[model samples]
Each structure stands twice: as structure tokens, then as C-alpha cells.
Target: MSSTQLFRVSGISLLLGALISLIAVLLSFFVNPSFTAPPATFQSPLWSTHYSLFFTALALTLIGLPALYVRQRGQRGDRLGFFGLLFIALGTFLALGMAGYFISVLPMVAAKAPQILKATLTETSFSIFPLGGTLFATIGTILLGIVVLRAKVFPSLVGILLLAWAVLNLLGFALQSGLLAMLVALLSTLASAVAYGWVGMILVQQAGVSGEAAYQPQTALR
Candidate 1:
């Protein structure tokens, strides 16, 4: 009910979301198909499970964003943090759309219309959602990292790690290897989760402090 309680709830939500996202990342390592794999790749149960987890992660991450924004807003570099939240929201929504396609549409198409597989694979640009989402996510993360460094809200190392991950992602994209890009993207996603967890912990700590501060005032009035 109180501001402190709100912060605590928000912090825990984000921490849980980060953990879910990490699990999704791990699932990818086991289940994701190679770009060159045949249409049969979509038939695997593991493939379905992978994207399901991804969908779950996107949902959780989306739920946590508001809390993260609330925590960061009005702090140092608030404007940058706002932009970061905007980009993250857009990217997450796009990713959600893509995940749904992979989980549902792709599998059906592979089973019923195998002839279309090569064409679908060849026209990677047709589904620009992932690419556009990655661009926004990468830029947003870099900007937020800068804000983190300037604000000193989270550890400086967290900011630096985000910046490094963004750079690696860009390099992967530039190299034009789908597999390599996917690997880098997974690594960066994991790092982002960790950074989010760190921010969540900080919020938890702030909540505790605010709780105590509020309690003391109440006791004085009693």
C-alpha cells in the first residue's frame, strides 16, 4: 500500500522476470534450430518448448518494465532512462510477435506446406520484426547503460557489461552469420537479465530504507 511496499513488489517482480528470462535463454541453447536446418527442424518438440519459454520470458519482461521505469524515473539521467524504456517496450512487443510465429505458424507450415520452407528461410527479411527489435533493444540497452553510469544507481560494471554486450551484438549482426548472431544475442540477453536483477536488488534495498524511514515517523506520531 505504501511507496516502500510498491517498490518491494516491483523489485521482486523484476527479479523473478529476470530469472524466467535466463531460463528461456538456457532453453534456446538446447532447442533452437540451425538456420540451415531442414524444414524438419520445426517438428521437434524441443523447438516448440523453446519458443514457449521465450513467450513466457517476453510476458514477464513486459510486466517488469513499468516497475523498472518507475524506479529509474526522476533519478539522474531520467530522460535517457525514459527513452530506454520506450525502446525496450517496442522491442519486447516485436519479439513477442516473432515468438508466437515460431511457436505456432512455423511448425504448422513445416508440417503441411513443406514446399514453402526454402522460400520462407530465404526471405529472412520478410520478417523484419526480430531484426528491428534487436536494433531497438541494442540501442536502448546502450543508452540505459550510459544512464546507469551517470546515475550511479546500479554498479558501474553493470553499465559497462551492457555496453559491451550491445557492441558484441552489433558485431554479430554486421558479420551476417545467423548462427553467430543468435549466439551473441543469447549471451547479451542473459547479461541483460543479470543487470535487471541487479537493479531489482537495488530497488529492494531502497524499499527497506524507505520502510524504516516511514516506520520511524509513524512511531513518533504514536
Candidate 2:
């Protein structure tokens, strides 16, 4: 009901999201083997569980993101943090849709429209929005890293981890063709989970001390 309570809830949500997302990332390797392949990988029994966990992660992240920025930006405002939150929120929402499709629609497609599913996996260029969402989220995270350093809301290590995650992902995506790239991509996910977890812990600590600190402008949309 109060600002402190809201922040505490947000912190818990972020921590839980980070944990779930990390688990999903780990399970994905058993399913996809490669970061960019989805052709035959979807047949794995873990596919649904992986995406289900991913969906839950994104949902929790979305819920906590507002408080993340609110707790850091203070009354003066930081445009960078606001935009970062906006980008991440939009991207996560899009990714959630893709996860839902994977969990629900893809199965039906495989059963009834095998050809469609095959094409969707092999040459289906239309389903690129999930990639787009990832891009936005990555960029947003990088921006947030910078904002963190500037705001001094958390330890410098937290920002460094966030930056590392984005940079590694960028490296992986740009390389796009080697075993090294895949490893870098996987590292990026680990860095992301650690960064978020660290930040969430700090947020929880801040919440307890924030006291009567009610932040206005709940979201960038306002």
C-alpha cells in the first residue's frame, strides 16, 4: 500500500524473475543446442516448460521494472532511465506474446499444419518480432546500465554486469556464425541473471530504508 512496500514487492518480483529466466536459459540449451536454431528443437519435451518459465519471467520483470526506475530516479528525473524502462517494458511485452505462441499456438500448428510449422521454423521470416524484441530489451538494458552508474543507485558492479551482458549479446549476435558466438550468447544470459539479481537485492535493501519516499509518475507512459 505504501511506497516502501511497493518497492519491496518489486524487488522480490525482480529476484524471482531473474531466477526463472536463468533456469529457462539453461533448459533452452538442452533443447536448441544453438542460439539461433528452432527448426527441430521445438520437438523437445522441455520446449513447453522452457517457454512457460520464460513467460513467467518476463511477466514478473514487467511488473517490477517500474519500481526499479522509480526508486532510482528520485524526484529530479532521469530521461535515460525512463526511456530504458519504456524500451524494456515494450520488448518484454512482445516477447511474452511470442512465448505464449510457442506454448499454445505452435503445438496446434505442428499437429494440423505441419508444413506451416516447418516453414515457420526453416524459412519463416515473418516471425522475426521476437528477435526484434530481444534487440530492444538488450539495448534497454545497456542504457539502464549507464543510468545506474550515473544515478549511483546500486553498486558499480551491478552496472558493470548489466553492461557486460549487453555487450556480450551484441558480440554474439554480430558474430552469428561460430561456436564462440553461441558461448558468448549463453554467457550474456548468465550475466543478465546475475545483474538483475544483484540489483534486486539492493532494491530490497533500499526499500526498507526508503521510508515515506513516495515516487510519482508510475511509468514512462504517464
Q: What C-alpha lDDT do the candidate models reach, one value each?
A: 0.76, 0.76
RMSD of 1: 2.8
Superposition TM-score, candidate 1 onto the true structure: 0.83
Off by over 4 Å in 2: 33-40, 75-77, 121-125, 172-182, 210-222
Per-model TM values vs. the true structure? 0.83, 0.82
Model 2: residue 150 alpha-carbon error in angstroms: 0.7
Show the lowest summed lDDT stretch of 10 residues, model 1.
28-37
Measured on C-alpha atoms, candidate 2 has an lDDT of 0.76
What is candidate 2's CA lDDT for residue 76? Answer: 31
Clashes of each: 0, 0
- Give the per-residue lDDT of model 2 (tens digit) for 1-222: 777887788889889999998888777556653324454555556878888998998898788878878878762338888988888887787788888878877766766676677677557753565677778888898888888888886777778988898788778767764567657866887887787777778778888767524333344337
**lDDT at 35, model 2:** 26
lDDT score, candidate 1, position 163:
88
